[model samples]
Target chain A: MRVITGREAVREALREEMQRDENVFIIGEDVGVYGGAFGVTGNLIEEFGEERVRDTPISEAAIAGAAVGASLLGMRPVAEIMFMDFVTIASDQLMNQGAKIHYMFGGQQNAPFVMRMPAGAAEAGAQHTQSLEALLYHIPGLKVVMPSTPYDLKGLLKTAIRDDNPVMFVEHKKGYGEKGEVPEEEYTIPFGKADIKREGKDVTIIATSHMVFKALNAAETLAEKGVDAEVLDPRTLVPLDMESIVKSVSKTGKVVIVHEAPRRGGVGGDIAARISDSEAFYYLEKPIKRVTGPNTPVPFSPVLEAEFIPSEEKIIDAVMKLTK
Target chain B: MELSEAKKLKMYRDMWRIRQFERKVDQFISRGDITGTTHLYIGEEATAVGAINALKDEDYISSTHRGHGHAIAKGSDIKEMMAELFGKRTGACKGKGGSLHIIDTSTNNLGANGIVGGGIPIAVGAALALKMQNRDEVVLNFFGDGAMNQGAFHEATNLAAAWNLPVVFLCENNQYGMSTSIEKAFKIKDLAKRGEAYGIPGVRVDGNKALEVYDTVLEAAKKARNGGGPSLIVSETYRWKGHSKSDAKVYRTKEEEEEWKQRDPIADFEQILIEQNLLDEDKIKEIKNEVDAEVKEAVEFAKESPYPDKDEIFDDVYVDREVEL
Candidate 1:
């Protein structure tokens, strides 16, 4: 086992996949000699050559559309959007074309491309900071992946490349620097599975991406307060591991869903609805709670941004309300 | 660039097939057998047939909303196309894609896009794939005058030129982009010159002349296959019918429509074949009868095909993974 940053883990996954499959290539802005805006594709061009590690002009629509088109022709292209917010510029290709191509074309073709987007608030102002996983999750054909640790990032990214469908791989900007243990041997995690970060008995705290760490911290504080809270991460949003979510919620009978995205139309609401709609409804001792960012643009001020992103205090507060 | 007699006759036959197919589609829409509206390729048949004919059978093509002509030109089974328009399980898209999205991957015909300029980047990507694999096959991207305005066209063309990918951008300038004439939409008369901005060679041809289009595209495709990079070919033509079935004849004058109709590509090509002794009156009538019979069979096949089962609606969203709805 080796400890590495989430960024290094992603680069490793990409390098390994590129070596395994000649069809795999990277296409995006600043991915080649520039190494990517976040440096997740660091020095890949030096090893794989410019052909496999393509650097494109500042064209988001074409980048996404090219990935879809190349995928239809049997190329596994991994397209990178510098920021998640810019994905809006590429939404037509991702939503209208790539997401609907397989179903619309009567299964004659499938767009097996991975669109890597760096998301979450990083004090980069309103336009640059936003978690758009909800937007991608709503699309039927897209598989949404958001990993919390280096291990998950490495495993899930490899799986996304091998998937025979469009995958929106959302990486948290702040989580890139976070370090975790990863095995030296190759591995891949399957979709539709949840990882319980911390096992507990009194309450369940569901989170995703950067929010997973916040929930874990909140669980640590809750444990000292004599309230044991379970922390669960539904790693993939589209093929949501509701079985794991409902099982944890049924045992605890109290739930708090946390995410960095805004509360209105957020994935938390969907999880809440699913819990209420399932057999877990009878086991609930309290109404489901949500600790999410308010419905407004992320602020530029560090203090405001700190408040804008859901914190460990917010998670603990929401959990206490349900537990007490 | 002399073409064989068989190839010339095929160009004429494909042009006629598109004309006759579109005419039947008009009848089907009027009779309420086809529900959704379609952008008929009545007058611009030569551009599709001629450009597609210029490519090898293994080459690929990306089409537009008015795509029935391109599909036929690229050898898609008309029965599947008709069944798709009729919304049956036997359709090219299994009844999911209507007239707007008919795709036949078996024929290397990438699906027709409902969005203007949407297929441009996809074609560029396909070309990118071919180039990466070191394949000699080229891709012919078919779009309209309207798509030239889209940002996608600029982005895709630039990428193709920058990478020297094997693709030919064939713009069918059939006058109007849904009521907006090219005169009002573009400042320049020749849309081909736009290729200069991306540093690719541009050529404008009379779309009514099938042989001219074929010659121009053949040269471009050859250059692309030889690693000379992408080119832009603008085929200036006109759409005889309205933009769609729902459009009333109000944008242009009837005199203008009749004037363009006088240069009907099918009739013009038929006359050329006759002059070359490639076809005679008897052969022309026989070809018409054969095409008419084929069109009739396609209609009957489409009419008899079953609608997709309701439960099958959940299929094809993903290849191997099933998502919980």
Candidate 2:
């Protein structure tokens, strides 16, 4: 086992996957020489050479289009959108062509590629900071992944690269510096499985991406107040871990969903609605609450952005209210 | 490109077959047997047959909404295509994709696009894959004149030129975009000149003349296969009917329509066949009857085919959905 940051874990995953399959290649803006915008794909070009680690022009649509075409023909292309906000440039390509090709052609096509996007707020202004997991989850064929730890990032990312489907690996920009122990041996994490970060009986805290750490913090703070909280991290949202979520909810009989995205029309609402629809509804002791950002763009100001994000205090207060 | 006598007759026969098929589809739509609307390929038979007839079936071709002629020319089954139009379980896409998205995997005909320039990027991507695989195959992408204005065209073309990918961007300029005149859209009469933007060779040919399309595409295909990169070929044709079944065709004049009808691709090809002594009048009549019977049987087959089951509606969305949540 080795300790590495989420960024290095992702690079290792790409390096290992490329070595495993000759058809696997990397394509995006500045991925070749510049080592990716966030330095996640550093030295990949040196190891794999330029042809395999292609540095495309600043064309998100072209990158997505090329990835879609290349993957359909059995070549695994790992495309990177510089930021989640910029994915709008290629949304049509992903939403329309990449998502519907197989079904529209009667299963004659397969878009087996991974699009790595650095998402969520990282002191970047409104244009650069946005969590688009909800939009991606709404699309049927596109698989959505948001890993919180180095281990999960490597395992899940490798799986995404290998699967014969289009997967959006949305890495949290803040989570890149977060360190975790990853196995030296190769491994793959299956989707739709939730990790019980902490097990308790008072309330179930369902957190995603970077919010998992805050939820963990809240659980620790809740322990002091005699309110035991359970933190569950659902790594993949599309192939969601409903069974695990309901199991946690059933154990606790109360749930709180935490995410950095806005509350009005976000993925948290989907999870809350699903829990209400599932067998967990009868087990709920209190109504589900969402601790999320407001329905507005992330501000450029540091104080305002900090206030915009869901804090551990907010999570703890929500848990305390449910416990009371 | 020199063609044998048999090959030349086959080209005429394919063009005739496409015309008959389009006519049958029109009759079916009018009679309410075929559902939904279609962008008919009535006057552009020569453009499709001339291009696809010269390329190998393994070579990929991305088509536009008016795709039946391209499908037929690229060796798709008329029955499956007709069944798809009828929305049947026996359809090419199992009734999932209708007339605008017909696809035949047997001949590697990529599914047609509903959006104007959507298939352009897809074709470029396919060519990139071919290059990456070190395969000698080429892609022949078909779009209308109006799609040239789409951003997808520019991005795909620029990338194709930069990467030196093997693709032929074949434009069927039928002079209108759902009743909007091409002249109103662009100032250039020869739309192929747009290829200069990417620094690739662009050629224009009389679309009503099928042989010209065949030779031009054949040359492009050879150049692409020999690492000459991509080229754009614009076949200047005219749409004889409305864009779809609902088109009023108020944009063009009756005089203009009559002038184009005088150069009907199928009729002119028939005349050429007779003058070349390759097909006598009796032989011409026999081929026409054969094609008529073939299209007629396709309609019959589509009529007999069943609509897809409702259970399959959710299937094929993904390769696997596991247990539904």
Q: How far off is residue B305 in model 2, in Å?
A: 1.3
* Tens-digit per-residue lDDT, B11-98, candidate 2: 9989988888988889888888888898889999999999998788689898999999999988889999999999998888888888
Pairs that clash in candidate 1: none
Task: Give the number of the best model, judged by lDDT.
Answer: 1
How far residue B89's Cα lies from its native spot in candidate 2, in Å, is 0.8
Where is model 2 chain B poorest over a 10-residue stretch in terms of lDDT?
A: B316-325
Each candidate's interface RMSD (Å, one decimal) is 0.8, 1.4
List TM-scores for all candidates, in order: 0.99, 0.98
DockQ score of the complex predicted as candidate 2? 0.68
Give the distance in Å from residue A157's predicted Cα in candidate 2 to where it truly belongs. Answer: 1.1
